[model samples]
Target: MTAIDILGIDIAKNVFQLHGADRRGRPVFKRRVMRDQLLGVLSGIEPCTIAIEACTGAFCWARKFEELGHRVKIVSPQYVKPFVRGQKNDGNDAEAICTAVRQPHIPLVPKRTKEQQDIQALHRARQRLVNHRTATICQIRGLLLDRGIAFGKSITKARRMVPDILSDMNNELSEMARDAIAELWDLFCNLDRRIISFDKKIEAVFRASPTCQRIAKIKGVGPKTATAIVAAIGDGREFRDGRHLAAWLGLVPRQHSSGDKRVMLSISKRGSQHLRTLLVHGARAVVRTAPNKDDQMNVWVNDLRERRGFNRATVAVANKNARIIRAVLRTGEPYRAAI
Candidate 1:
């Protein structure tokens, strides 16, 4: 009870490990409590800074702790790993969290509000469905290929060709094989429908959010990218600047350097891959169409594409767009493209 300044909780499904430290980082107490008893235990202690690893239930717990007037710092698991002493147990993990939270330089994970989490959940669900749909398409193609039938890779082509192939008796497809492909085709259609439904929901979310609309004004950013960036980092305040946001999105290049030699590799690819992908895909579209536009952004994109090639140009546009997004969010101003 030596005026605990920071408390770390290694959270799990059932048991919870707690480590309390004073302002000077000295351990005050260590204990283990059940899930149901967690609140009761914390309610007795004076409100202090609580540290937890960013994992499955960390955000929910952070919200709960904040309600109890305790400041919560959620550090990424990788950042906390270096601070762990001895073997990796619940107690040691808790101590590691406590130590990591005390470090002023370590970047903390942004605390997401309930609405942001819901948006992310929607994105995750849609991504999964998309993956399933892709798999189904590939499966359909592979099945047909085995029977010496070949068609274009386009999803539309596959949908039109498959039924014709199944109906024709001149092909090598057996009845059982046709039945299996039919089942998979049905599954693909179902998944496609589900994905469309999710798309509508995302559209609704984008239409409702003014922040999403403002950022979407950027040439490369669509409603999807705008919603995703907002969902990931509310007003972009957590990041120091737009490059910080780009780096968080893994748009920044990785570096390996010593002495006077500096070697930069591909993008670090950190943070959310989903958001990064959306940004890059949107940027690619913009880059592709840059040749037709006379805006400042398009001119830069066209010149970069000619010099660095298409892929590099696309990534460069993504980085630039991320910075623009951060500025828009920070200043509450609309993005204006230069003529």
Candidate 2:
């Protein structure tokens, strides 16, 4: 018996509608299943390709479906939205998903493992705390500056200055406002400590992974970027080459073509914005100190800097670094400074 080639699912928090087709491309099944019953139902079905939109809980469900002896593929919602037929309902969406899945070059999102989810959670929490701390400090500085006391712009100096600024008895702050300030200050301290702990934890993981160490050796690759890349691309076999890796990170140019006249602009900035930011920032750091190093990469960076100022050069370097990362991860090759 031939196996099913395409199956579309419209997923929801409580209920799901599944649309399945037989191997000959004829509609064979259309049914609604409760969330709890979904796995049991899928488990009984023979191994077949499953298609879904990449949305909340989709990845987790994909993992579960894969465990149940089915192949799962997730497509970007934007691409699937066009196929949505009249009246936007679960059945229509599922049918759209089926249509989208059959496109020859449908881009499939990689399914993340449980470990990747955990590490990503840590990264998200750390980022939120860092943002909160920044906002808290800004509020403190603004309140103090209202009374003629201003903090230095540097975060390090601000950290130390906050205590002395708040402890001043001469300040006109009301007792209630002062207490609130104190509480905020304490919260900032706690956020800082927790951030540091997470930093250490991430570093420990980075150092322990041979793949992470290989990536870290490359210039401009830091703990967050390295770990994210490692987690996102567990095995490089998923990508054909470095360019594909860069494209996945949305490093390639955007395309707008009509009647043979085409234009390409800045990077698409479509996927993994955080990862892209990390790579670009790290590239800036490398560009700033390129003169101190003597290597082909250094020369290349310097040449780019001379031709296209530092900012664009940084982006170029970051793009290249992203490619290098893909190569190293895919081939298990250690990084080497260019000749």
Give the true-structure RMSD of model 1.
Answer: 1.1
Off by over 4 Å in 1: none
Q: After superposition, how far is residue 159 of candidate 1 from its true place, in Å?
A: 2.6
Give TM per candidate.
Answer: 0.98, 0.93
Q: Looking at model 2, which ten-residue stretch has the lowest summed lDDT?
A: 1-10
Q: What is the C-alpha RMSD of each candidate to the true structure, in Å?
A: 1.1, 2.1
Residue 226 CA displacement from its true place in model 1, Å: 1.5
Winning model by TM-score: 1
lDDT, candidate 1, 1-339, per-residue tens = 598999999999999999999989999989999999999999889999999999998999999998988999889998999999999899999999999989988888888999999999999999999999999999989988988999999988987888898789888989999999989988998998999999999999999999999999987888888888888889888889888888888999999999999999999999899999999999999999999988787888999999999999999999999999999999998888777
Q: Write the per-residue lDDT of candidate 2 for residues 118-223, one digit (tens) a residue.
A: 7777787888899999999898778777767777877899888878877887877778878888898998899999999999888887888888889989999988
lDDT for 294 (candidate 1): 80
**What lDDT would candidate 2 get against the real structure?**
0.85
lDDT of each: 0.92, 0.85
